[model samples]
Target: MPLALALSPFLVLGFGALLIMLAEAFGSRRGGMALGSTIVLFATGLTAAGLWMYGLENLKGLEAVAPWLLLDRFTLFFQMLLCLGSALAALTAGGYLPEHELDRGEFYALLLFATFGAMMVSASGDLLTLFLGLETMSLGAYAMTAFRKASPRATEGALKYFLLGSFAAAILLYGFALLYGATGHTDLAGISKVLRAGAVKDPMVVTSLVLILVGLVFKVSAVPFHAWTPDAYEGAPTPATTYMAVVVKAGAFAMMLRILLTAFGDAQSMSWSAGWPPVLAGIAVLTMTVANLVAGRQESVKRMLAYSSIAHAGYLLVGVVATMRAPQQAGASVLFYLLGYTVSTAGAFAALVLCGSRGRETVSYEDLAGIGRRHPAVALPLAFFALSLAGIPPTVGFFAKWFVFRAAVESGFYVLTIVAFLNSVLGAYYYIRVLVYMYMREPAVGAPVAVPMRSGYVVAAVILSAVMVIVLGVAPSDTLDVAVAAALSPG
Candidate 1:
């Protein structure tokens, strides 16, 4: 009964997806799937909200479920966060899909399926379930990225994302095999037991750990493994890109945190070499520095944001690295940063969706000129979101950084903290440049542009982001407590 309750949202989402497929196969019109999708998204949102409240009610004593999934505080917390992020992205897609000539019922179905898979990944207690959930999410995302098949850019982007994503998946699976062979178990807890048994001096253990880290690094867009992010983000539909940037990152990070806490718990094991800490630390520095510098030089705003996403990944990794060094601060900082990241990123993407003109492909920085005068409503939100991304104070991003940096400092990683702070300064240039163009520059005469009047949902996304940015900034103790509880779970 407990396991069933824990899995309710995923089951609901899958059923909704099946309903969409059935509608597509049997309905007379192509829009049947679309109708099915809207209903499914709404229903899934309601279910997720209910599940989240229930999980909160039982956070103190949440338990593992069926050896495959864990229904503890951590999983439940992330499950809710990912669901809310996905729900907002779905709402944004609701409007953007119809406007871009890409409306299809299957799109919504796929989105729900991806969300369900992401939730599973966060809650998974074993390697097999994690891999399964990761693939389900990736497959759905691949299709959605290419939803605008008629556009050359979209098709090209989807192809690149698919190829690279498949390669990453293969690497992860191979790593899983190596791990199972070395540890004689597929479950995370079982593997941890083997690793902590003082006999993990074998080279095979090290090989498994390295392979697994390499595979996961690619998923989170760490430097030297982030080649696919910019092209995919630039090429995919904007709302889909938002989902990738926000929910996908959160899920991958959750998995990374779990692996560190459970599978690699024993520091003396062959799998826990001192080399990994420095290596990860270096990767975080390289990712933040390179991405911030490169983002400043991009002509396309979407591509710039793509680089920004990579930079944020670097920041998140700082928390992961801190966790490896000092477990306690790692938990609170990681979850807090993820929450701040999801809201700020969703708001940024929503602003982009609002900027699209009818029958025009949205791209480039120059496209936003003088929007402050023309569309104060859109411009204000975009500015706020951009400022948040730049880590401006009183915004969510600032507090997010504070949490992570404080964690890093507590862990005695002064060097990583300095690098992160400097990178944020570098990141500010491009983000502020967007605002400069939006509010300061003159609109080019005869440049075709249309700003849609605000919808309640759009206003709501902006308000939610802005309000949370402030609230979380001022009263982060409760949120931090929740994240800390989740982090200390025994699965």
Candidate 2:
């Protein structure tokens, strides 16, 4: 295949973003921007899948971008997932921005551009490209977080996210710069070769590894670095929150996998007793424990979901740590979890968007009281998604967690697995609380109640996410196969 065709996913999204930017610059109507961006994303996803089928190795001229951007199965898999998640976020934005009187064309432009950055991060094969991608994705997220410029919460959240994110980026850059100074290589393969050959124990290498790991763990919203998540999720528009939860997290984890496996996959560097495995295990424990405890205390469902996002990061960390002992199984489990999470989280957020009209947003539990009886349409989808997020049986989220836990057990992390299992049980409480309020409780007398809004765009996003969640839950074999292939693919 021609390199352009092989690279069509990146090309389409890149130029599509520019076109959307230009259109927004000149056009008056904002209605078409969302559809345009969604179309671009769907096209990118379809093309990436097609290239995966065509085979990455068979494609010619890929060397033109060698050692910086790769078209491996891993990259292709995330390309597809990011586009799918981004498309859903854009669809949600279509209805949400208009209904809230925040209709601005730049939102779609940011969506497309942010997705472009995520795809870059997924495809990055070098330290420089990774930093570039991280910044691109983050800038768009910060802008989106402050989309509601009138709200003080939005401004504060955006400021915090940007400042903290910038620091994280600087730390990551310094880490990789040190890596280059030690190994004399910025390409991942060269770094790995050097580390494995010698200098694996060099003080610089050790320090860089820790710095990079901290930068990555922060990006994933793990504990000790998750102070930005709740405020950002609470302050951002719901669809933007969905984008961060799904697309941005996926990209960050992909960055982790690529950097860790390719550059630090040496036995000594990944060992359970002396390396990142134990560190991540400790982080997984803290993240799940802290996030679950704090989430249960949240009166705002949005804030609860924010903490839930952090908790899920811990679960994914378990799978990452499991990669120390079982690379293929653990890696595949992580990929599958990300896929399931992308749909389930998006669906849940879409339901939140549906639960609110202009003035009566679904912020607190009381806003949701009697919602199941009054707005079955919105409540039912939330129920299904909430069940999925809580990892109930016969749902995508359950399988997502099951595979990760199974991988952990297989890796001989019985105690760690047990702790994770207990954490999940604890996390379920907040998820179940949603249903209880929606079905069992009643709004206070004379209290303002949420009136479900009607928006085909929002409903479309909800249905699309719900269908994927159910289909992948019942027939996960094909998706699992793809994930395993990606896991076993070239690092």
Top model number, TM-score: 2
Worst 10 residues of 2 by lDDT: 482-491
Compare the candidates by lDDT and give the number of the best one.
Answer: 2
Once fitted onto the true fold, the runs of candidate 2 whose alpha carbons sit more than 4 angstroms away are 488-491
In order of appearance, the predictions have TM-scores of: 0.92, 0.99
Model 2's TM-score against the true structure: 0.99
Task: Give all candidates' CA lDDT scores.
Answer: 0.79, 0.92
How well does candidate 1 match the true structure in TM-score terms?
0.92
Number of clashing residue pairs in every model? 2, 0
Put down candidate 2 lDDT per residue, 1-491, tens digits, no spaces: 48788789999899999999999999877788888988989999999999999897887899888788988899999999999999999999988999999999989999899889999998888998988999999999999999999999989999999999999988888899899999999999899889889778899998999999889998999999999999999999998999999999999999999998888888888887667889999999999999999999999999999999999999999999999889999999999999999999999999999999898888889999999999898999999999999999788999999999999999999999999999999999999999999999999999889999889888999999999999999999899999999983323
Cα deviation in Å at residue 384, candidate 2?
A: 0.7
Against the true structure, what is every candidate's RMSD? 2.9, 1.1
lDDT of 1 by residue, 377-440 (tens): 7778888889889998878798899999999999888988999999999999999999998889
